[model samples]
Target: MRPRSLDEFAGQEHVVGEGSVLRRALDAGEVPSLILWGPPGSGKTTLAQLLSAQVGAAFEPVSATSAGVADLRRAVERARVRSRSSDTRTVLFIDEIHRFNKTQQDAVLPQVENGVVTLIGATTENPSFEVNSALLSRSRVVRLEALGDMQISALLDRALADTDRGLGSRAVELEDAARRRLIELSGGDARVALNALELAVMATSDTNGSARVGPEDIEGALQQPALLYDRAGDQHYWLISAFIKSVRDSDPDAAVYWLARMLEAGEDPMFVARRMVILAAEDVGIADPQALAVAVAAQQAAHFVGMPEGYLPLTEAALYLAVAPKSNSALRAYAAARADVAATLNQPVPLHLRNAVTSMERAMQFGAGYRYAHDQEGGLIEQQHLPDGLTGRRYYEPTDHGAEAAIADRLRAMRGVSPRVSYRDTPRPMIGSKRPRGQAFGDRTLHFEPHVPLIGGRRPNTSRSCGAGSPIPR
Candidate 1:
């Protein structure tokens, strides 16, 4: 049975209540171009259908899976003709609107802007990423939430007794506990609730002239194979969530345990492992640079090994990722640097830093001020190397933790002296390749300049160079 009006719509009162944007739009008897974003079976299509009924507008529907730019063009042309013939506006409902690529989205933008068809696009994905800015700019995004336990309960209650639209006359009685089971199984998805209800009702045999559907009956009615994830049931999202949170919480033991649950369910180890890798970086950064390396290695190991066996490396890596001291400073630094570069896109490089690989290039301004650091006292010098406006711009701010402290110390010193100057004034270069073993740069300074004279008659230079080349400055 068709729901007569918005009042018949269940849940999401926050969006469908009086004065709510959607509520007001429907009451105004006009629905503009809009995107309804939410999870599956949240009544997006139903809302579109209701909009057509309530506003007395003709509705046209298309699936993005099959609809292309040409398909959208045709729909718009048909809508235009329909308005001309029936003197009525048409609303084009696109399910999975996020599936539309840029060109497909662009094709529909003009019509939506010109009001040729009031577009009602629906998507389960984040529309901000899938929808182009221009299309999104012209559409108001309406969010739909999953049905709550109470709402789902009410839906099941209605389904059990509504004679016209439900299987009430079929001699079936749903136990309260069983009803709760169905509600839990539905995962706030109404369609799933109805489908499960249908299965349970159909399975019920007449008990004393009235079929009594108990928890067992309902359980028996469920799909025999059991869905990989009960999209509507309790087991679907809960485990995935637990798995991710376990990794984030840094309980390697818990992380591995949850991972086992997913893997046992035939979950994609690569998907699970990929997320672990992200957690490794996003949740565990410079505090343990090895965490990311471990994660990457595990991903490759998992990919090559595949599941069952591949899960071993994944478990080991997950443990390391969970145990690693957490830090996001490096990730943040990269983001800051990226933001700076984008703001100054196409900025010209300084002439001195430009490559002078060709003989002619060296004659132009290329490498004009470039220096060789190896020629200096401690392989140190000062010079400008970045673009004119962005020289010495601090992008990566290392955190003083883990092995990163060494990096911070080195950066501290390098910051004081320009890299270009180090390259120029140094007795050596940045080293076209890794320096030979034991061939270190800088003064091996175990000897102090008598910052404080020895209180006791001790060796003045207690520290001695281990080899011919040492990093310590004399």
Candidate 2:
């Protein structure tokens, strides 16, 4: 049953409660052109009707999904005629107002501006994004929230007891368990709860002239819970946001719960997979380097397998990311470097770090004093790799978590700073380096000796050449 007055309204106390702005305005017979924004079954249409009744105004209703510019003009003409002939105010209620296009919404703008009809636009979307700015600016937007369990229960009770508008005259009894199940399935939508309750009562066989609706009856009436999700609406962004935040907060349970909610509600699995990939890089960076690989693999697996089975890999990746060691050092390092790039003048690369590809370039000393790390002891040499303007600047600050702890120690030693522990004992082979079997740098022997040539069946020269013959610096 729809609320006939503000007093009968079960939820949204903040909007129309005693001493509230809309309540006071209605009491004063001043109904402003309004935008009622909220989730479905939140009493938007009922509130509009009540507002018109309170002010003794004629109510004219239209559905934006079906109404066009012609329908709007006709309604405005009727209101204009009524206003002149009988001085009666008309409340033009447009349900699903966000469905109207720019042209259709624009047609109502002049009518509202000139006070031909007091427009009451009801939308299940954020009016700011869906409604045209001109119309939104002219209307006082009032946000309605979903009804809570207590509010829904109160409404259900009213329906069962009120003989005039509800099912009270049918001698129907609703079991407590059935009521709870109905409320849960409704997802805080009062209209769904009331309709399902009515169905349950009607479907139950009479027991001695009175029908008793139990949990089974309620479940049968509502075959499955309708999830309150709109893929192109606020729910889409909100669910994904919650899922990412839960993973970032390292709550595996919450992460998986939100993941299941999205998948069950028909969200694009690819969309969820993409966001997870981003989260793995942004939130679970170098602290556990494998996190990025896992997220990417999950995305590929989900795409390859397609949904139903795709959710398996998605769930696995969500758990992996949630429990993995986290570090934002990579994100912060890039941000710090970006700030320098923006703040400083465009600086030239150091001459030694540049490639001397041409003879003229070699004469200009492009590769003047660049040291070859392969020839140096420990394959590490003290060098100025940064530009002259950024001689001592540091970007990457590895954290002491998971595999990054070892990296941080190695970096400290590379920078000639005393590390918390020795890292030289575990020297690994440099990437793409193929040293001869007996070659040694200082006392550390090369553990990885390739049997075949590294590139094109020719042994790569491992010398201190810095001119044209040397490989270009990565």
Candidate 3:
């Protein structure tokens, strides 16, 4: 049953609750051209109708799927005539407004500008991307949230008791279990809940002048729950973000749960695999160096085997990453280096560090004082490898986690710096103890940088090769 008035409307208290902006506007008979953006069955159409009636405006409804420019022009003409003759406003309600192309949307802009019709456009897509700038600027977008369980329950109760508009005439009695299951299956859509409830009552056998709806009846009526997901819409981004964050937080359970959600919802398995691959490098890093290999193997396995069997490797990779020691040192090192590259002017490699491929270059002492590590004791010697301007800058800071611990110790030894005590050797931090800020290496503080998506295919201008005399092409 549709809500006839704002009072009867459930949920979206932020939009039309008492003392709210839209509520005040509607009460003052000053309804503006609006864009209602939300999921299906969230009462976009019903709210538009109620708003039109509240202002005593002539309602002209059109579906973007079936209505074209001609239909829109006719509606505008009707609004013009009505406004001139009877001094009545017109509310042109377009459902699925995102379906309208730029040309079709443009056709209505002039009418809206002149106030021939107060447009109320509804869309399941984000208006920022789908709606054109001119029309979007003119209309105020009101976002409606999905109905919560309590709100949906209230709507069901109202439907069962109202004989005039709901299924109250049938005298249907819904079992508590059936009601809960129906609400769960509806996915916060009041229209779906009401329709399924009506179907369940109609299908169930009448007993003692009343049809009793059980869990089975409700399940049968619904058949399958329609997941609130659009592959190319917000759901895609939201689910993937949840999955990545869960893995980064080292919550294996949450990671797997999100993975299953995405996979079962028909998200491209390859996309999930690719993101996992990036996560292995960006989150797991050298803490568990094998994490990258596992992620890569999973990607290959998924591509080779294909679903539904492909989920096997995908699940294994997700678990491995979630449990692996976490480190963003690799990510941080790259970011530090990248920032320097972006900020500083191109600095040439030192003459000693450059290759002298030609006789003429050798005569100029290009390879003059470079100490080859292979000729030095222990294959390590103190030498300036970086350009003169950046002779002592350290970029790669190895964390004391997993395999990186040994690397950190080696690096300290090479740099003539004493290694700090290992964190694993010490007693673990007590539960609820304040975690040390950033990457902890005993008493030393190494700031951990947050993960940032890498922009691929960018190279520094001063990059050079050891085997060639020329600078590497950018």
Candidate 4:
């Protein structure tokens, strides 16, 4: 049975409850063009109906799947006739409005804009992506949540007791456990709960006067309720979202369960594998360097082995990723670098770091004085590598998780030069030309003096060319 009034509406107190924006609008008879957004059987259509009736508008309902431009025009024409006869305007309720393509949706715009009808669109899909921007800008989106167990139970109770529209006329007795089973199978859907209840009542044979419906009878009626999944539709995205979140949150059990659900629901194994690979890099990252390797191997394994058997590698990878030490440092570092590039495009490379592949480049002081890092004592060098403006720009900030701890330590040791060169402690860029006297960049040393002692002994005054092709000044 459907709720006749806002008071009777079981859930969605956020939108239809007392003092809510929609409720306030309804009270004043100033219902704007609106979109009712929610999951299936969450009463999006019913809400639209209630809103139109409350505002005393002539309700003209149309299914977007079946109705085309001509049908829309006819509905508008009927509304015009209704307006002429009475003071009441029309409420054009478009069910599954998301199903309407951009061109089809645009066709209804003129009618809605002209106040010929107050458009009320109901959609299980997200309205932002599905509904046209022009239409969205003119409407208010009211999101409805899936009903909870308590709400579903209440609806079931109402169905069992309501005489007029419900199965109150039948000689049926619904047991407590049977009621719980119906609620579980409904998945917080009122329509589903009522339908399952009806099936259970109709199938049960009457014992003397009343037919007692047990959990077994309810289970039989439900017969493994089809999971709310469509491989190419909204549920696909929703399940993947949940799966990703579960892994990110480090819940191995949830990660495995969602993985199984997607596989069982005919989701592409390759798609799942791709997502795992991305998650490994984006979420687990260098904290667990093995995660990316595992994910990639899983993808290869799945492709090689094929379905049914392919699930083994996929599940193993998902579980491994879920338990790995988490770090988004690599992802964040890339984001920061991208922002910098966007902000300051085409920054020139430092002279010493530039390649001098040609003689012309060498003459221009390109690759002027870069030293060979391996020739140095500790395989450490002090050199200007980053573009001039980004001398001390620090992008990669490693967290002390898994293998990243050693990376963080090494970075601290290498980047640590002067007391002023503490890039790790302070996030600001080093602006001035003050270079650390004996600081090492990788392995080579930046010796301004003509003759600095070499690792073993100083070489004789011979013409020695650096890696950058700069001749040592004699």
Candidate 5:
């Protein structure tokens, strides 16, 4: 069978073809140590083969699941011998590279640095966490996207008409119905489509060798065992991606479902909790500031109490996060400030804000003109804290998605910040007796999910439940 080259490489036109990143790199004849990141059947391994073939580099391949440090050492040794003998570097291709732990991954660094081999690692998992940071830095990551429906259909069309590798002019025939079924079942995986088509043909063939392929003949073929990861494998990370997206999407029920998936996968409860903690701070920032506290507390409590028992805290945390008024304003604030610091690393800190922690330091004109907020009874001292040239720059703009409505007003009044608040300055509270006037205490707050089943299953009195029809169970 003829191997597919760059000219024949289907899909990912963004990265391949003339004037593209890969094309340019291949033309240069020495591409960076690369990590191809994508879903299965997105041609990660194929790309590796293509890379080696195009560049005239001998490819040495290893499977991460089966290859140990010993196997790695031998590959390294072989590469060394080949490089010295041919005076040409080899491409050490490692598939499922995330399976290699830190120590094994560390061994490849020196080889990569020495140019004895160009490390071409393939992993479905995000390299930032799975691959060692140093090794990742040495490689340029190329992300492959799942083929769209159009691409999948086009591939199927080619398979149906091509007589060589594909089953064109075969004893079996593929109807449009059969084609649609094949494409749908492939889940954008090319290997899956080819394998399924092959299976359906075999199933339809008679003892005398006459066969016909149709929707009926391929029904069982649809259920054929996967050619790829049987269990979730690294694809389980994709579930976490879905979960994070759901949480970000703000559908509590959907978030709960993703949590259930991660939990069932035996994903570390603490790790899940940690992400929740991060999400609470990163996604549900000052708009629902209490969520970060709740998430962090749940993580600590779950850790301290230790599982089965720990699940309650986790569940509660998820629920709180799901229902919390979501905001990324605080996250944006920090990011903006960090960007400013990075852009102006050499800019001097204004003198007034500098520490007067020592008398000698104080004598060096430190803390000369600082205004203390505490000195004012209201804790409302108006003073500039930014660099002299960078004053009145607004970094945090609050959205009224949740608690931010009130926060939007308060900060607007306090800092002269003009915010595009999405909701009214004062939204009616759930426990609305006009919000019990004067100095609200933080203690004894009532909270509940709107769609959650009422406590003890009691539908409230129609007229007496505070002008509300249903007494939502707390």
Candidate 6:
């Protein structure tokens, strides 16, 4: 049953309760154009009607989905006429106001500005993103929270006992478990609970006089099942996090299930697809080079194909990523490089590495003796490109996982020589043992502070030096 008066309105005490701004405005009998933003069944429509009645204005309801610019013009004209004839203003309540395109929404501005009608718009989406800025600026956006369990239960109790507008005529009684199930399945949605309750009572034959409804009957009435997901609330973030984590953990089943849950909850499939793409780069990485490509392709397909068929590519990409070889080496490598850049800011480029573009630059030997690697045997030669004081610094550490293993081998060959020290093979330092002395090496020896705290700190017990014959320092 719809609430005819604010006193009978269930929940949303913050806005319509005693001494609230809206309540005070209602008392003043000069309510301003306002926007009610909340999830479905959060009493936006009912609130609009109650407010119109409170202000003693003619109520004109329009659905933005069906109403066009023409409808707005007609409503405004009617309001203007009513204002002149009866000296009564209109309160135009546009449901799903966000559905109105910018042009259509703009059509209501003049009337709203002139007070022909107090625009009471209702939206499930954020007004800032949906409603025109001009209209939004003139209205106070009041946020209504989803009805809690206790509130929904109280509403159900009222609906069951109220003979005037509820199912009291049928003399229906709901089992305790059935009531709890209804509340849970409704997901804090009042309309859903009421509709389900009405259906269950109507579907079941009254036993002698009172029809006894159980969870089974309630479940049957709710044909379109839904999880307790608030797209604009915290559950939205939690669900997406769970989905990404499932994909990262390489659990195809969990990933697919979460993806389905989000899709069913009306989450933008494109949003989910975009997250999968990030997961491909961050978690899957070069271990499966195709993962990123598949994720990007899925995102593009979702946009191009749109819903229903779009879900196929989205799900396929999720599954592909979940089963692909996982690696965070690329992410770690980049982080390391970034850390070095931050720590050693403004290090000068080595003379050999600088481009010898001008005569003076060539005289300063910016690119002197720069070897042409392609001209050398096997198109490889030993050369240091890092700036001075940072020679032999290593950032990208290829993992032994999947495709990276081959990359590691290729990288080792291109680099001319590998660090001979085995960090894992080194024994742990004994208590009270001395810090190991730096071993002798050629001019290529790269000394690093023993406690310099490198990014991820160079695999436990590893030596920091990156030249040949470097020992695994204790």
Decreasing lDDT order of the candidates: 3, 2, 4, 6, 5, 1
TM-score of each prediction: 0.64, 0.86, 0.86, 0.82, 0.56, 0.67
Give the least accurate 10-residue stretch of model 3, judged by summed lDDT: 465-474
Q: Which stretches of candidate 1 lie over 4 Å from their true place?
A: 67-78, 207-209, 224-268, 271-297, 327-474
Q: Which ten contiguous residues of candidate 4 have the minimum total lDDT?
A: 436-445
What lDDT tens digits, residue by residue, belong to model 3 across residues 282-398? 998999999999999999999999999999999999999999998888887776566555444466789999999999999999989998877764455556677665555666778
Q: How accurate is candidate 3 locally (lDDT)?
A: 0.83
Model 5 C-alpha RMSD to native? 14.1
* 294-315: candidate 4 lDDT, tens digit per residue: 9999999999999999999999
Stretches of model 2 off by over 4 angstroms after superposition = 207-209, 417-474
Residue 213 in model 4: lDDT: 94
Q: Lowest-lDDT window of 10 residues in candidate 6?
A: 422-431
Per-residue lDDT, model 3, residue 209, is: 49
Distance from true position, residue 145, model 2, in Å? Answer: 0.8
Clashes of 4: 9
Give Cα distance to truth, residue 439, candidate 5, Å.
Answer: 24
Clashing pairs in 2: none
Q: In candidate 5, which residue ranges exceed 4 Å CA deviation?
A: 1-3, 207-212, 215-219, 224-474
The CA lDDT of each predicted structure is 0.72, 0.82, 0.83, 0.81, 0.73, 0.81
* Colliding pairs, model 5: 455-473
User: In model 2, what lDDT does residue 461 have?
Assistant: 71
The candidate maximizing lDDT is 3
